[model samples]
Target: MTNSENSSGSILQWLGFRGARGGRSVDGKPAFANGAGNVFQQARRHLLDEIAAFLLTYELDVTPNNLLTAHGAFSGSNPALARKIAQHVTAGLAVTQEWLDEITAADETIDKHDGIQHLMARLETTLESFSKNANDTRSATADYTDELEQHVAELDQVQGTGQILSSLADLAKAMLERTRKLETDMRRSEEEAKALRRSLEKARREAEIDHMTGLPNRRAFEAVLEREYRDARASFDPLTVAFCDIDHFKRINDTHGHDAGDRVIRLIAEMLATISDDNCHVARHGGEEFVMLFRGISLSEAHKKLDGLREQMAERRLRNRKTDEPLGQITFSAGIADVFDFSDPRAALKAADEALYTAKQGGRNQVIIAPKGGAQAA
Candidate 1:
């Protein structure tokens, strides 16, 4: 067969359709569907247009990060979830832009303040020089007056008096100019310093936030966990740690796509965030895993909380939009361990991980509690 014929066959195989050769349509024209002239080209153009529209509609920039994020959003089983992820990405971009603005403001404010300091330093130096000059002028005037007294001569004393008066007037004019400049420089510096302080505050707040889900990231979680653990240790209160994993998460990715997997992750993250409060901390621990720190809660209370979350997840039914097919039950398994039960807080985390592993093995949808001292799951 010719190259064009071979190409036509490949397109037919890809689309899972076979077209008859040398076929005629009802209109007595060459049937494009039958592997005939420019049909493949037309289809290719249409597909490209559709892809371009998808990219434009989602505002998905053709960069690696954006492309990955968009892929995750669109490949998901549900359109609603895709839209949520898109909105979330947009909000994240906005926050990032806000941070850039604050940092920029900080840069400008620091530069402005630095300029003011330079001006003030210059003014101070000028004032000091003017003061020395004034002192010298006074000393000269005193000497001139004394000379006039000592020499009792008419022309010499009169000339010395004229010179002393002229020096004093010049000194006063220079001092006045320096004082005004110093005042202006000081006021401008104070204003810029205030602006710098505000930017610093914004930076601190944004630092703790996770760029993906707007929840506290792992770093923030660790900070809170350490402080809470210490406080709980001192007060002899219970502190529980739960390690959560999305069950068969890899299967979701394999079946639907990574974007679909991402949707599931975001959904669970949002649910965790919504259920958490000031006393409790929830954080993504990379991939389809999460960690929750429950301060001042007993083992049973922590277990109950996580199990409740698992049940909520069990109730959710995610579906594929294109195929109108169910993606099956989405669930998470959790392992909870109380920090007070162990000598080391790190041991508690190990216990939680162990429990999580057990939960995963024990049929993949339950909360398992690990005993103290990294013992077997309770």
Candidate 2:
């Protein structure tokens, strides 16, 4: 018998189905007896009914190989039937592989990266037109002023007729009124333009900053780190990084609920922003963690600044809103490392993480410094 048939037959036997020709009845009928045929027929019928139910429910495609494998695995206990099922499974997998290849090829034909460039070019053109319009508006206002002045000079030089002088005065007043309306319209237009520009800038800034903390997010932090690293390399200025982790953050969440946890995070974020220098860029790395980049500062200096911030945080008295009782103080563990020695921002972060792990291991509320090329402290 073929391998596929053998596999299917074994599967059928394992599933408690008897073969058609070799079935020995449980009532002690001879192996090759005609009475065994009746039992095998009943088993085959039941098995086929199950296969039909499965196919109907699953809505499987009625391929010849699938049908044969399904039939053999359900009713036949022969080794050859089992082998056929295995071969059919392999063929089915090959078909799926071909389908995936076709889909991927079709996708690759249409996928391109030119849309972003086109959009940027279009934005630039729009900005240029806006600028030109502004210049044109300014020139038009100046030209109108010059014409009004010429009109005034003409009025002064006119013949001594009171009616003509009065008529000219009325015409000049109407012209001035029209000019004032135009100026008001122009101011409104300029205000709209300024509003649009501010909206775009606000969107860009929001994209780089964390929504909850109002600090730089991970993407912005990475960009700033690269910039700082380049600056440090060129000027040989000291650059340090501090990896800060809030202590027992999970415990706080479990004990006081996520609302309290969020409040604590926001409070810490505000305190960090207030304590850090303007040059220092603080970012919410992710979930109860923060990163601080100190430009032109030594590791010791960074540690001192972080230490003070930690103390300030620990001293703050946060209370339960309903009970008026203390909710317990929040503390953070920090790790400090120099940015100059690390090859990449991630490496510097890893150094700081190592130090943070050390701090956590030692106790939970202390700062640990990872030196340039030394073992982590405990």
Candidate 3:
């Protein structure tokens, strides 16, 4: 009885359907009045049904995050999300809650700066202990030799059996000399051990770092991960872990050569370093890949920080130094996971890797967050 009815009548009359409230089709099925409002309702109903079917197809929950995600994918408003879902489908991957949560949020993870420093400090302490023990052993042997000589001299002064005293002196002198030689040998051995220890220490420190980028290497990152996990738990502070890989790195190497690729790798490392701080840590995970850790920050905040770095890198167009060839915009894909969300650091790391895989498949250069069931930081 209002404009709504009038609009319905207009739309219905245009379609040659009689009346606005109740109508029937050629097949004898009850139909809409064919009004614009009725048409919208029909499409809305269908869209909701499709969303429900999608949730059922993947056994996804109807939580707000999931619901909005499903709507975005099916409603065609978010083409990127739709494109990512299509990629997952094409790859035959299960449309999972974790994957959906990750892609929808879009983020990264954490690494603490002090983790490797802790390892190096502990190693230095151990080396120092060994050095101290070797010196102590040498000093004690020298003093014992001196005391033995004094005892033998006192025995010589006593009016004892001449041959017995002489024999005792001779044996004492031999024992003293041998002890002295042992002390000398101990000193030499200690010196050589110290030298070897220094070399070993140097090698170990180097091993923990990427020579090209001077960032901690993959081995170092694992140590950092363990320590950061423990510290974050103890402090009840938030921690995040992330895996990053340069997008299309292989193409760069193939097209521009390894030298240029190496330059690109260093550039990426330097950019990552710009964000490194007491709370944020970065490392060179391996060839064209890196790892990050964040402490005392929420997942969303950490994601913003890392995403900033990602965007900054993408905005820059680089050129090959040697050949002066334009390399276009260089970018990387990243995956972030909340450390406390998982039972352990390894589990979080695995989740981050899975997220990283999705980011790559979702058309690289974006940060993705791997969301497991939520948990308190502790």
Candidate 4:
């Protein structure tokens, strides 16, 4: 038998099912096979059925990327990868739910930011008014003091008690009016300062969140990473960082449109959030990429977690709801490195990037751990 025929037979034998050979169905569809055919023909039919089932179940488009991703997930030796694929396939639903929550929170934050910006502007205007009024009050007070001193001096030289008393009363009334105006300005200024303090707090929160994914943005991530790195070094604690990138993300954008691409980004972000815990921090490193920080975890532990996540990502079949077309499987490659192994944070990130490069080169949907020493500059 030919290699194809031999392979077919082996697969059929492994499945414990015979192949069908004799009949044609009325619809011109080959009669459903019930175990009778040449090994090659049976194998081809079985493969076709499996492919159809996969497409139907996942609502995936019959694209080359989807085919390859599905084949890897179904038959790959690593069970973790397969399970991960399954997780990815199911991630779309989870993404939808998680996105709603994030969008709601995001909307609330945006509103607060808007409100604070308005308040800050008003406070700025009020403070300016207060500054002007305080200057005016000081000048008025100086003029009033001079007038009172001159009136008293005049009163001492004059012969009438009524004139001196009248001047004294007028001076007292003028000083009391100036004191009340100053007090009002001071109170208004104090309230404006309080509002400004609140606005600053809101501004800080707005700065830290990524507008697209609602995850911590790179700037915030860097601050947290630096602090953690410093603490880990001092205490000799386990700290690991992973760099992750989506496979064929540009192709997805080109093929499915930008809206679909956005969905993919949000999906991945939600997935990361779902998998993370209090000890694990997740951030969007930028377009189609992410970074994860695992505190109190060694390189091996981080590797295991990321590998599973990678597998899950591979299994996810992204689709465009508008066209009802499968966008194809979403897969990622990742690299993990121990923080303490590197001399600095940048070096650690570089090593993780190199390991990620290796993973992508090896295959588009796996994880690789960075070498112990560190990664060389690319």
Of the candidates shown, which would achieve the greatest lDDT relative to the real structure?
A: 3
lDDT of each: 0.70, 0.73, 0.79, 0.73
Instruction: Write down the TM-score of every candidate.
Output: 0.52, 0.47, 0.52, 0.56
| Per-residue accuracy of model 3 over 99-153 as CA lDDT, tens digit each | 8878876721111335567778999999999899989988879868876788668
Between candidates 2 and 4, the TM-score winner = 4
lDDT of 1 by residue, 1-378 (tens): 223323322322322221112233565433444553586765554343333434454444566544443333333422433443334333443314344335435545766898999999999999999999999988879857865564445334445777757755755676688788888888888888998898888787678776667777777888888899888789988789999999999999999887788878888999888769977889987788899998877889978988998999899899866566788999999999988777677888888999899888889899999986676565
lDDT of 4 at 324: 89
* Residue 150 local lDDT, model 1: 46
The segments of candidate 4 whose C-alpha lies over 4 angstroms from its true place after superposition are 1-171, 375-378
Model 1 residue runs over 4 Å out of place are 1-182, 320-325
Q: Is candidate 1 or candidate 3 better by lDDT?
A: 3
Q: State the lDDT of candidate 4 residue by residue for 105-148, as single tens digits.
A: 55457668989999999999999999999899888798588776
Q: Could you tell me which 10 consecutive residues in candidate 3 have the lowest summed lDDT?
A: 12-21
Which candidate has the highest TM-score of all? 4
Model 3: residues >4 Å from true position, as ranges? 1-181, 373-378
